[model samples]
Target: MKIMNILQIHNLKPQFPCTFRTFPHHSLSGSLNFSLRKSTRLSSSSFLLLLVTPIRPTFKIFTVSRIEAPFFENNKEEEEEDEERNSATNLTEFEDLAPDGVVYQNTLRLVECSMFAAVTGLVYFLSNSLSIENYFGCFFSLPIVISSLRWGVAGGRKTMVATAMLLFVLSGPVKALTYLLTHGLVGFTMGSLWRMGANWGLSIFLCTIARATGAVGYVLTSSFLIRENILALITINIHASLTFIFAAAGINTVPSMNFIYSLFGILVVLNSGFFVFLLHLLYSVFLTRLGMKDSLRLPRWLEKAL
Candidate 1:
C-alpha cells in the first residue's frame, strides 16, 4: 500500500504544475489584446465626434448671421422719382420768390419800347411833309400806351417825355411841338383811358375820335386863317385821319401819293394796338398767377405803413 501511494503522488504533481503554468500564460495574453482593441476604438470615435461637432456649429452660426444682416427694399426707379419731385418743388419756390427777375424784365421792356418809339418818330418826321396836318403824329402814340399798361403810367410817361424831348432836339421846334401835341397827348389820353377801365374796343374808338376832332379843328382853323402854312398843316391832318380810318377798317391798301408815309402810319397804329392788348393781358395773367388780387395795388411804403 505504501508503494502504490508514492507513485500516485508523483504523477499528480507533474500534471498539475504543467496545467497551472499554461493557464496563466493564456489568460494574461487574451486580457492584454482585448484592452488594446477597446482603447483604439474609443480614441477613433472621439476624434470623429470632435471634427463633426465643430463643423456643424460653425455652419449654423454663419447661416444665422447672414439672415440677420439688413437689406434695403427700395428700387432705383423709386429713388429717382423721389428726387424729381423734390427738384420740382424747389423750382416752383424759386419762381414764386423771383422779384428781381420781374423788375429786370420790366426795365428791359421799357427800354426796348422807348428805343422803338424814338426810331419810329424820327422816320415819320423825315418821310412826311413838315406840315402838322400831314404828319398824322398819332402813329407814335401806341408804344407809349402799351408801355404804360405793361409797366405802369409812370414808365409810359417817362418814355413819352424823353421821346418828345429827343424829337424837339433833332427836328425844328415846330415839328417837335406838333409831335408833342399829337403823340404825347394821345399817349397820355390812352393811358388814362386804360386806367379808367376802358377795354380794347372802347380805347381804340376814343383814340379815333380824338384824332378826328383834332383833324377837324386844324382844318377849320386853317380855312378861316387863309395862311399857306396853316393850309399845308390842315392837309397833313386830313391825310393822317384818313390813314387811321383805313387802318381801323383792316384795309392794307397803300396810299399811292406817299408809300412810306401811309405804310408807316398804318404799321404804327396796328402794332401799337395789338401790342397794348397783348401786354395788358399778359400783365393781368402774370399778376393773377402770382396770387395778386389787383394789378393796381398800393405803393410799397403805403402798404407797409398801413
Candidate 2:
C-alpha cells in the first residue's frame, strides 16, 4: 500500500510528455518527498514482499519558469526602425528598386498602375468615340509602355488587365480584345525588352514578331466576332493591287491563293516592323527627356536622326 501511494504521488507513468526543447531557456526546479509509516500488524512476509518487489522508474515533474523572451523589446524597436527607414528611402521611381522588406513599395506600385489604367481607358474611349482614330491611335499604347518602363512586367500586366476590363465594360469584347492584342501587347513586349536593357535591334525584332502575331490574332478574332471574312477582304485588295502592277508590266500572270497570302503576310510583317521602329524612336527621345537616359540604348544612326 505504501508502494502504491508513492507510485501515485510520484507519477511513475509517462503522464507529462514535455521535453526540454519545448521550454527553451526555461528554469526547472522541483523537489520530491516520500514517507512510509511502520505498522505493528504488518507481517514479515509483507515486508519481504516490499523489499523484493522492483520499483518502477519515476519522472520528476519540474515547474518550468519561462524567462521573458530575449530581445522582445528590441524586436519591437527594430521593426519600427525598419518602417522608418523604408519610409525615409521611399522613391518616386520603382525602376530597379531593391526589396525593402515592406509593403510600401507595393502600395506605390498599385497606385501607379491604377493611374496608368485610368489614363489608357479614358484615352481609348475618347479616341474611339470621337472618330479621330488616325491622330489618337498613334498613342494608344503609350500608357502601357510608360507603366512597363517605370514598374516593369508586373505593372504592365496589371495595367493591361485593368484597361481591357474597363474597355469591355464601356465598349465591348471586340474592342477590348483588339486593344489587348495590338496596343497592349506591343506596349508590354517592347517595354519589357527596353526595361531589361535589351538593345534596339533585338528589341525591335522580337516586338515586330509580337506585333505581327497580335495583328493576326486580332484579325481572326474580330472576323469571327463580327461574322465577316476579314482575310478575304484583304486578299481581294492585294489581288487588285497586283493586277494593276502586272498590267503596267505587261505580264499576263494572275496571283494564286498561296502567292496572295504570302504577299499579305509580308505586308503585315512590314507594318509591324514600322510600328516597332516607331516605338523605339519615340521612346528613345521621350525617356531621355524624362531623365531616364539609360532606359534604352539607341544606335548612333537612330540617335543622330532623333
- The candidate scoring highest on lDDT is 2
Candidate lDDT scores, in order, read: 0.57, 0.79
Model 1 per-residue lDDT tens digits across residues 62-178 = 234455534754676688999999999888767655765665576677677678568756765675555554444435665666667666677677767777677777776655655
lDDT (Cα, 0-100) at 91 in candidate 2: 52
Prediction-by-prediction clash tally: 4, 0
Worst 10 residues of 1 by lDDT: 14-23
Q: Roughly what TM-score does model 1 have, to 2 decimal places? A: 0.35
| Candidate 2 global TM-score | 0.65
Per-model TM against the reference: 0.35, 0.65
What would the per-residue lDDT of candidate 2 be over residues 1-306, giving only the tens digit for each residue? 786677679876323232111112323333233434343234334556656986543455677898887756888999999998887667523433645534667878899889888888888888889987778776777777778888888888899999999999999887899898888888888878877888888998998999999999998997998899998999998899998999899999988888999989998999999978887787677777888776667788866776
